[model samples]
Target chain A: MRVGIVVFPGSNCDRDCARAVAEVSGRPAAWIWHKDRDLGGADLVIVPGGFSYGDYLRCGAIARFSPVMEEVVAFARRGGPVIGICNGFQILTEAGLLPGALMRNVGLKFICQDVHLSVGDTGSPLLGGYRPGQVVRMPVAHADGRFHADAETLSRIEGEGRVAFRYCDAEGRVGGPSNPNGSLAAIAGIVSPGGNVLGMMPHPERAAEAILGGTDGRALFVAALSRAA
Target chain B: MKARVYVTLRQGVLDPQGRAVLHALSSLGFDQVRDARIGKYVELEIADGPRDEAEKAVREMARRLLANPVIEDFRVEIPGEGEAR
Candidate 1:
């Protein structure tokens, strides 16, 4: 399976995502520049983490207007698999590919730490390898990572089972102190209504290997790649 | 002409940064502060035109890129044209 990783001007985690894709699928990922309109015939697209456009005017606001995003949005509209992580997630929301906006953290501080997340709906192929209620570890680094939506939108997504993950304690209990960013409903991740696009705050690419201190994130890559194959 | 745009978090939306500032104010003995909210102010220099036309263009700009309608509400004011509703 071919994977395409989008690299914006200020993106710092593009290489990390490429490495994770290579490790999981045994193939180097194509690097698609933000200014390019082509996707390089990739079967799956990944929008990696980092402060795009130097986080100007909002974390992902400027990056959403990048030329490559036009193609990415088209790809997603055609039901192609798209995974947006961290700033990538922020971009997806800004681009209207996903619902809700990521607001500043409740503490008004940049937090960088490993957080536990309970797997929610695995209906999307990107998360098929996980079981419902399974807890996994991954690292989140951001100043604006709190997921917010109107009451009606929140209910609609929840009713449709679009939530992909929720912050939780090690034992899988959700809410309270375990909610790292104070995201509404403790949401850590969500998928598009078609179940093709996945947007999450945690850095799965940063935790996909045993040597990286955890392997819980490998399942997402493995499942996405295998499903495409 | 110059258009001043104010973008703020909509009512009912959480504003953590604003809350932090509120707490700091209270700690400094400014107990009269009931609530605080933070927002952005952007000034745009557009081509001089009719008052109505300039106001309309600035409002469009605010809707398109200056503010995210989902989370923010924006108000536009032209220096001598009064506030654009």
Candidate 2:
């Protein structure tokens, strides 16, 4: 399976994401720059983590208007799988691919560290390889990762099974410290209506190898390849 | 005529920068300041033309692109043109 990693102006995780994809799936992924509109014949597009546009204007604010995102949106609408991590997730939300907005941490600090995440569902192509209520260790870096949506919208997302991952403790219980960012409902990630698009605030690519810490995030790329195959 | 767009986060949306500003103000002994909301002002240098028409276009830009409707609000203002007051 081929993977495409979209590279925005300030994105620093494209190489790492490509490495993760290559490591787990053995796929020769291509790095598509913001000026490039094509997906480079890849079946999956991963918008990797980083402070795009220097997180100026707002996190992922300037990058949303980047030319490549238009093509990414079209590809996603066609049932193609797309995964956005960290600031990439914010770009997706700004591009209207995902629901809700990621606000600042309650403490108003930029959080960066390994945190436990709870896999909420297995039906999504993005997280199908994991089990529900499973906790995985991954690094999260962002000032605006607190997810917020109105109560009605929140209910709709949950009801539609669009809530893909929630922050949790090592024991798989959801709440503060475990949930780290004080995200609404302790959410970490979410999937779109069609399930082909996902926006997650955590950096799964950072945990793709055992040497880094754990390989729990590696299976996600593997699952994408599995489904693409 | 030139137009300006003001973009601001909506109420109930958390503004960390604004919170920090509030904290700093409180620390400086400004206890009467109950809250502070952050916002941005963008000046668009559009060529002088029909005043009403230019303002309309800037308003559309404000709604459609300048600000996110879900979390932010935007308003357009037209500056006085070439000695027209």
Candidate 3:
């Protein structure tokens, strides 16, 4: 798969995300800058983590108007695969590709640590490697990872099986101990209505390699690649 | 002529920064705070011209750059004589 990572001015995780795709999927992804209006012929587009534009006017607010986003939106509308991780998740929500919004942590502090995530299902490619409610360890770091959606939208997402991952412990239970960011319904990630676009607060690219981190995040990219290919 | 824009998070969405401020106030021994929400507003002075043209440009500014309509909504108010604030 030809993967592409959008690079904003303050996107610190772009390289890591590219490396993750290259190592895990054996695909050398391209880096698309924020100013460019083209996507450079990528099958899967990834909006990587980190504070875009320093999270100045709300996370992803300024970056949404970036020139490349127009093409990204068009690509997504054409049923191409797209993933938004961490602040990328914030960007997806800001761009209206995903529902709900990320609020401040319940503890109101910047949380940067390894977190436990539970695969909710194998419906979407992002979690195709795991069974329902399977536990996986990955790192999460964000001050505004608390997901908030209206009652109607939240129910629609759950009822439609759009929730891809949930926060959980080793035993696969949802709560404060398992969910560090206090996301609504312990949601760690969600897919779009069409299931082609995904937005999550955790950093899957950070743990894609066992040498540098853990291999738990590796399967996610592989799954996307398999489907995209 | 001058134009002002107001931006705010939609209803039913949580405002973490506003909540933090309220928590800080409560911890400072001040209670009775019902709620708090944060928003941004900007005022811009521009050339005098057709009112319709000015409003259209300002609205484009809001949609294209000033606001993210998905999470937050924005409004433009070009103050005029005999106008309500």
Q: DockQ for all models, in order?
A: 0.72, 0.55, 0.42
* Positional deviation of residue B74's Cα in model 3 after best superposition, in angstroms: 4.4
Number of the top-ranking candidate, with DockQ as the measure: 1
DockQ, prediction 2: 0.55
CAPRI-wise, candidate 2 is medium
Per lDDT, the best of the predicted structures is 1
Displacement of the residue B4 alpha carbon in candidate 1, Å: 0.6
lDDT of 3: 0.85
Per-residue alpha-carbon lDDT of candidate 3 for residues A126-181, written as tens digits (9 for 90 to 100)? 66767777788889989988988878899999999898788888777777677887
For residues B32-63, what per-residue lDDT tens digits would candidate 2 score against the true structure? 99999989898888887898999899988887
lDDT of 2 by residue, A187-213 (tens): 899999989998999888889998988
- Reproduced native contacts, each prediction: 0.50, 0.44, 0.39
Pairs of residues at least 3 apart in sequence or in different chains that clash in candidate 2 = B1-B48
Q: Candidate 3: where are CA atoms >4 Å away?
A: B27-29, B50-75, B81-85
User: Which one wins by lDDT: 2 or 3?
Assistant: 2
**Candidate closest to the true structure, highest TM-score:** 1
Residue pairs of candidate 3 with colliding backbone atoms = none
TM-score of chain A of each: 0.99, 0.96, 0.96
Give per-residue CA lDDT, model 1, range A1-229, as digits (tens).
Answer: 7899999999988999999999988889999999998999989999999999999998899999999999999999999999999999999999999999999999888999999999997588889989988999999999999999999999999999999999999999998999988999999999999999999999999999999999999999998888777
